[model samples]
Target chain A: MVVAEFVSELRARFGIEFKDLSILDEAFTHSSYANEHRELGISDNERLEFLGDAVLELTVSDYLYRKFPNLPEGELTRMRAAIVQTKSFSSFSREAHFDKYIKLGNGEEAAGARQRNTLLEDLFEAFCGALYLDQGRAAVIKFCQQVIFPHIDAGEFRGISDFKTALQENLQQDGNADIHYEEVSITGPGNARQFNIDVYVDDKLLGSGSGKSKKRAEQAAAKAALVGLGVIS
Target chain B: MVVAEFVSELRARFGIEFKDLSILDEAFTHSSYANEHRELGISDNERLEFLGDAVLELTVSDYLYRKFPNLPEGELTRMRAAIVQTKSFSSFSREAHFDKYIKLGNGEEAAGARQRNTLLEDLFEAFCGALYLDQGRAAVIKFCQQVIFPHIDAGEFRGISDFKTALQENLQQDGNADIHYEEVSITGPGNARQFNIDVYVDDKLLGSGSGKSKKRAEQAAAKAALVGLGVIS
Candidate 1:
């Protein structure tokens, strides 16, 4: 797609548009296209993708860290990983109608590379890279808040389960009750330490589990308790 | 160490110090320490590590993306990985005297976790996370510039080899001449395509090599050509 139409479409769709269409155009320029059109000296989107991946990491991480304040580090990492996967980023690309604008080489175009999740993911990251380079992190974050954050907020990337929260809410449904996790046993060495934790609600044991860390064992205990309570199958 | 001493030492060593010593203290608090003092309800550094990892990723990526404009995505990724490794980050932590400030539980301290590479890396990240939270990205970047980027600039993370530039400089020692890479042969199907690329300098075939992608093949060709010219061993 040409720069003018892309800009107009962006304005119409999102009420935001960049003045330097060439940067966005650079984002749209796949490495395949650059390789084919080497004489034109057009910059490909790979470097942008690199920068954008970092931009995406920081933005999404900031969001997750704030939004899921109670979530442990392991769960937060898992959720962030899920959110940044090829599937998730490609979906974000489709939400932005990126396929309509990406300029691919004839071979790649014929190979349907535009529809591929990896390509789409890279395109989305490159788009972020372009936005970041043009306007900076705030602009990229604003763009993310528009197209990416909403989906994440809607639990589209709920691949990682937070069983602890569910269990706590289930037990605290009627009123505020104390819940605690205790390490019942620990085995193995420091590097491969295995911890077994028992979760109790109001001094009543609900479930027990073992894992490589106390946090992981607590999560497993919570999950088992949740299953026992018929909250999850 | 106490907060005041930490702050004073920071200023004395780096000529800069965070006003929020409490936040810095939080960054130093390992989960083991928090676990030991559960009643105190102090925060662990894991969350900060999460945030700081992303911060470090973005800042380092920004530096690398700008500094090595000619590097392809693969090389850039490898270099970034090298820069973000536990060893690299632990060394950065040591450079900032982080080992002296980290707070660990009695068990962990007795176990010598303070000197561990992974823990030191996490401490470095947590420090970045705290700086980002107390100030912002600019502050975090400034800290990185002070403590981390200098080592990277000095090529401390030179694990990833870059042969293309060396060969080009070697060929262009006297004057500028056309250097080109041409696709010579292809094998296998689309999913397993192997490409043979030949590097030519002033109509002379310098080297030929094969790989999964044209860029990889080109790099391989460059490496081979460099080795052939005794530029690299």
Candidate 2:
């Protein structure tokens, strides 16, 4: 694609015009592209990706802090991780149609590198980095607030099996209730040990489950309790 | 110490007074302290620490990006890691006299938790978090630019061996030099293996070293080359 068209697309999509087009150019340029165009003095997106990773983290963190005043640190961390994971970021890039603009070497393009999760994730981050450099933090935050924060608010990215934390947060809403996990049984040989655990909320049994380890069993019990509490489908 | 005295110390040290002293209070309150003071509705610094961690990373990443324009992503990552590491951050906390301000439970205080590196590191992050909340990103950036950036600039936290990357950067300054590492020999049993490697800069034998693995041996050779090139003492 032509550079002007790419720039136009970004402007239309992100609602921000780049003061320096070179930063945007660098953001889309893969290392392979830079290597192939060494005489052109083209730089890769890796450095920008590094910078964008930090920017994305900070923006998401600040949003989470303000939005969830009562949420604990662990839950905040988990939620942030879920939002920024490669899968989530790649999905965002796909929605942004990043593959159409990324500049890859002939070989990488032939290898179908554009659709790769790692490349898409890196491109998304580098784009954010470029946006931050060109337009500043306010622009980047606004972009995230529009593109990323809504998904988080909708609870769309809370991947499988975080029910334990979900249940804890639900229970903690009322007050600090005495939540306990008791190992009810241990069986099987040493090499293949199994544990059955029961979860109690305020001295009342909520759920029970079995697993290979105490932690896993507790998580299973929590999942069961969350289901019983109708917190998840 | 009383909350007013804590607020005064923060103002004297940081040159800015918080609009809401409660955020500052939460920043210094350890989980143990919060646990003991549940009735007072005291909050721990962990959440702030989480926010601060992201703020610190973004500020540092931006600083490094601007300061070292020619640095590759890998080296920038390494430098950022060094600057924000637990040891480096804990040292910053110590220099800031964070121990004097942190509120811990009586039991934790008796157990000498004030001197712990982990606690100090957490307090430093929490302080940044509180500053970001009270002032904004600009203030947090200013705080880090004053406190953390200088240490990074001085190369105080480069820590142990990163000679391979250092050597590579030093050689790549005058354009890309052909740097090669070749395994010269492998000896000893499989479980107790030793390998000798030689590092060549532009086809010149600069240094040679031996270690248990190829990676280690290459690093050792790079370190010797750096020493021979008068780059590090």
Candidate 2 colliding pairs: none
Write one digit per residue (lDDT tens) for candidate 1, span A53-170. 9999999999999987777787789889998989989988999998889998888999989899999999999999988888889988888899888987776775437778778777
Return the TM-score for candidate 1, rounded to 2 decimals.
0.80
Candidate 1: CAPRI quality band: acceptable
Q: Which residue ranges in model 1 land beyond 4 Å of their true spot?
A: A164-230, B163-231
In model 2 chain A, which range of ten residues has the least summed lDDT?
A157-166
* C-alpha RMSD over true interface residues, each candidate: 3.8, 10.2
Q: What is the fnat of model 2 with respect to the true interface contacts? A: 0.80
Give TM per candidate: 0.80, 0.74
User: What's the DockQ for every one of the candidates?
Assistant: 0.48, 0.33
Quantify all predictions' global Cα lDDT against the true fold: 0.84, 0.82
- Give one digit per residue, the lDDT tens place, for model 2 in B43-141: 688999999999999999999898767556776798888788789789889887788888988778888999899999999999899899889989988
Query: Can you write out model 1's per-residue Cα lDDT over B1-233, one digit (the tens) per residue?
Result: 23577788877976667777778888999888876665676878998999999999999999988877667787888889988989989998998888988888888999999999999999999988988988889887777788878877776664435566667778899799788989888887754678898999999999998876666788889989998888777
The best candidate by lDDT is: 1
